[model samples]
Target: MTKPSSTDRPNPLQVACSSCNLRELCLPVGFSGSELERLDGMVATRRSVKRGDALFRSGDAFEAVYAVRTGFFKTQVSSEDGRDQVTGFQMAGELLGLDGIVSDHHTCDAVALEDSQVCVIPYAELEALSREFGELQRQFHKIMSREIVRDQGVMLLLGSMRAEERLAAFLLNLTQRLQARGFSPTSLVLRMTREEIGTYLGLKLETVSRCFSRFQEDGVLEVKLKHIRILDLAALRKMVNSPC
Candidate 1:
């Protein structure tokens, strides 16, 4: 875990209707007036977590579903020796607790890589509101569908792709996801450590480090400690498609 930075302070209350970036992503499409108010009312609070902060642990009692307002995070599982293996990375506007929606116990641990803010919506309240409104139910279904698709994509990345390609694909996916949430797609501040990234991609820490060097050499990206900027996304796309 890295040391805390200045932007890692806790978040204040969030009213979705007032946030332009959240209008479409958090609220249902064409949601207006009273419907939006009902949706907004479900948000219990907004909280901030610094890099290296844990949102919840595996097997913890699940109380709320967090919708990321900004920044990135990872969902991880622990091995028998208590080492973490990252299962997924989440961009802004993505829901982080869907896997536990039915189980009521977290399926994995979620940790913020960057100083991030997430809207904590009580699951019970959301369920109650969703039951009464067909539109809300439809919207909830769509969100779940997206989450499922994203998970499938990750499975493909991890199960089939080569080491460097897996790493590149992960970066490309992260950029696009963040871009949808109104963040820069080309330049990003990495939140995950090299070791953490290796765990997520099923690569060795040294291989992950060498892959960064290869990217820099190939003019695909530049990495300096914490900051990463994708210099040639097209090149990266090609690398991700390259045969091992």
Candidate 2:
């Protein structure tokens, strides 16, 4: 018997909403069994992206939304002055390209942080389907509302929070998200670079490094390269809540 080629290998991570554990955390929440089946049909194809590849570049034509099936991504925007800012990081089960729905063009670039797969859900078809399914319409509204709230939180972090407070809050937020996906709350890998973290937190790269070292000295967390271990989550929480 001939061995199968690499192209013929099956992907263990390629799964639809009906079989995905992340369904509860994604657009499929509150969807009935039949509704989930219908959603599966909307996902016409899954596209694989390599690390550092742009899933969709800024100002790209937006035809569909993507659901992360595996791996992580970072969305960023470039300023008029050529400075790029990290807007947000997306993980498995999250939706991307929603920023394009209103303007018909992507406002930010979505780059894969690792080899990833995303289910392509055509925006036009989704809109037509939502018109027929009230549950889906409501769920989509909730998803967009949640994104707004998340953006507001980022604003709060950058506008008023101190450097340490921002970092602590960021760690807590990451831990919460990973925990939701059945991952370890105290340990995880950072997909983005330190400079990216500093960019998102509105801090200098040196300051971000210093803050991490300070946290380690304070027993709040242990950071080695991109890996982080939460040594004292309560302490980190206290730092986030404490006034500067």
Q: What is the C-alpha lDDT profile of model 2 across 107-197, one tens digit per residue?
A: 9999999988788789998999899999999999988899999999999999999999998999999989999999999998999888989
Local distance difference test values of all predictions, in order? 0.80, 0.88
Writing each residue's lDDT as its tens digit, candidate 1 over 1-244 gives: 4866443444454555445366677745678777877777787477777778888888988888888877789999888898778988877667888778778899899988887888877889888998999898888899889778877987888888888898899888878867876679998877778988899888988999999999888888888976889999988888777765
Please name the candidate that would achieve the greatest TM-score relative to the true structure: 2
**Which pairs of residues collide in model 2?**
none
User: What is the lDDT for 31 in model 1?
Assistant: 84
Q: Where in model 2 is the C-alpha error above 4 Å?
A: 1-15
RMSD of 2: 3.8
